[model samples]
Target: MKRTIDFILAAAGLLVLALPVCIIYVLVRWKLGSPAFFRQTRPGLHGKPFELVKFRSMTDEVHKLDSERITPFGQFLRSTSLDEIPQLWNVLKGDMSLIGPRPLLMSYLPLYTPEQMRRHNVRPGISGWAQVNGRCAVSWEEKFRLDIWYVDNQSFWLDVKIFFLTIKKVLIRQNVVGVDVNGIPFTGTSAESSSGK
Candidate 1:
């Protein structure tokens, strides 16, 4: 039932947003150059790997700082979350859900504790409980806590609530890029104490 809802809504969303997505793609190409889409492997449901797609908001300039590689236009895409529009296709392709814990880098898979690994029980999402609550602004520990809470409590109604909250957060542009993009990576035990795991 949830999968049905995810597919229906994702397909509809992709259709409705098609023009805007195209426009964004063109703009990204003009600003960031060729290969306007960013593709990377991320852990999906059950910690399986899948290619997560987004607009390429950063430049390919090597030997530069992350801040330097990120152009102004890229910053705008990240702030408005326009970069994530491509993930609707991921949802349509059954690699993701319309609402679930946001997928993290595949490299982080081994760093997750047994409890934290439970987040992969459902399909990953473009937006989620952690996203609406604080997104990158929160500590890794706090984000994991929210993710686990959603894992335990997820339902159709809860997904609906998160959907709207995500819209509100994005419109308000709150907590977007509030944390350092190059902050230290997560370790398995880093957040374990907070969750009492």
Candidate 2:
């Protein structure tokens, strides 16, 4: 049922937003140059590897930090979430779901404790409970807690609610500031103790 919904919605979304996506693609190429898309391997269901794609929002400056590498156009893309549009293709490709735990970097996989690892029990998503809840504003522990809560309590209706809430968050650009990079470093055990979990 969930897969069905993800497929249908992602297909329709990609179709409806095709022109806008093209424009964004051209603009990203103009601004960022060379590769207009960012592709990185992320852990999917059961910790499987998959290529997660998004619009390239920063320059290819290996020495520079994300803060320094990101341009005004890149920040606009991040704030409006236009950069995330490509993930719809990942959903259509069965690499992700429309609603589930948001996939993080593969490097984070080893950092997850047994409980945190449960987040991968379901497929990764373009948006999820943690996204609508507080996103970068929340602590990593809180985000994982929300992710796990959604893992346990996910239902069709809950997904619907989260879907709408995600729209609201995007419209308001909630917690979008400083989102060029992941908010806090999750040091596995240290985060657990700091959050008193």
Candidate 3:
């Protein structure tokens, strides 16, 4: 049932945003040169890997940090979440759901404690409980807690709630952090940050 909804909505989204997606693609290409899509392997359901795609919001400056590489247009994309429009394809591809725990880097797999690891029990999402709650504004530990909470409490109604909240957050542009500025790398389990509960 959830998969059905994800597929239907994702398909509709791609169709509805087709023109805008193309415009963003062309703009990204003009502004950032080739490879307008940013693709990365993210852990999906049950820790499986899938390529997550978004618009290229940063310059191809290998020597510079992500924070330094982000362009003004990229910041606009991030603030408006236009960069994520391409990820509807991921949902259509069965790599993601409409609502679930947002996928994290595969490198962070080993860093998660047993409790925190439970987030991968379901498919990753473009928007999740943590995203609407605090996004990058909250601590990584707290984000994990929210993720786990969603993992445990997820339902049709919950997804419905999150879907709307996500719209509101994106419109208001709340809690978004600059690239690599506030999203601290998770090292491993610690007394202060390990518990996902």
Candidate 4:
């Protein structure tokens, strides 16, 4: 039933937003260059791997990290969340849900504790409990806790709430920049961090 809602809403969203998406695509290409989309392997349902796509917001400057390569237009996309519009296609393709835990990198798979692994019990999403609550502004531990909570308590109304909250967050551009501007990667499990690994 949830998947049905995801599919229907995603399809409708794509249709309604098509023109805006195209404009963003052209703007990203014009401002950022080729590869208008950014693609990365992300863990999906039950730890399955899928290529998650978003608008390319950073330049292909190998010498500089992602934060440094991010242009003003890129920041605009991030602030407006135009980059995430492409993921509606991922949702339509059955690789994601409109409301669930946001997928993380594949490398983080091994780092998850048994409890944390429960997040993968359902499909990943473009926005989730963690996103509405604090997004990148929250600590990894808190985010994982929220993810697990949503896994345990997921319901239709809950999803509806999250959907609206995501809109509010995007409109206000709150907590859009979760990590540091240096593009520091997410550190691993707390234990690993404690061990300096």
Please report, in order, the local distance difference test score of every candidate based on alpha carbons. 0.83, 0.85, 0.86, 0.84
Number of the candidate with higher lDDT, 1 or 4:
4
Give all TM-scores, in the order shown: 0.92, 0.92, 0.94, 0.91
* Candidate 4, 1-197: lDDT as tens digits: 98888899999999999999999999988998999999989889999999999998899998996669999999888888888889999999999999899888787788778888999999998888988887656677777889899999999999999989988888887643223212445556777653446
Q: For residue 83, what is the lDDT in candidate 2?
A: 90
Per-model clash counts, in order, read 0, 0, 0, 0
The sequence of per-residue lDDT tens digits that candidate 1 reaches over residues 58-169 is 8999799777999988988887888888999999999999788888878788877888889999998878888787776677877877889999999988999998998888
lDDT per residue, candidate 3, 1-197, as tens digits?
99999999999999999999989999999999889999999999999999999998999899998889999999899989899888899999999998888888899898888889999999999888988887777777777888899999999999999999988888898743222217567776686655323
Q: How much lDDT does candidate 4 score?
A: 0.84
In model 4, what lDDT does residue 48 have? 91
Cα shift from native, residue 58, model 1 (Å)? 0.5
Candidate 2 per-residue lDDT, tens place, 59-146, comes to 9998997789999999889888889999999999999998888888788888887888999999998888888887776777778889
Q: Give lDDT: candidate 4, residue 176.
A: 37
Backbone clashes, candidate 2: 0
The candidate that wins on lDDT is 3
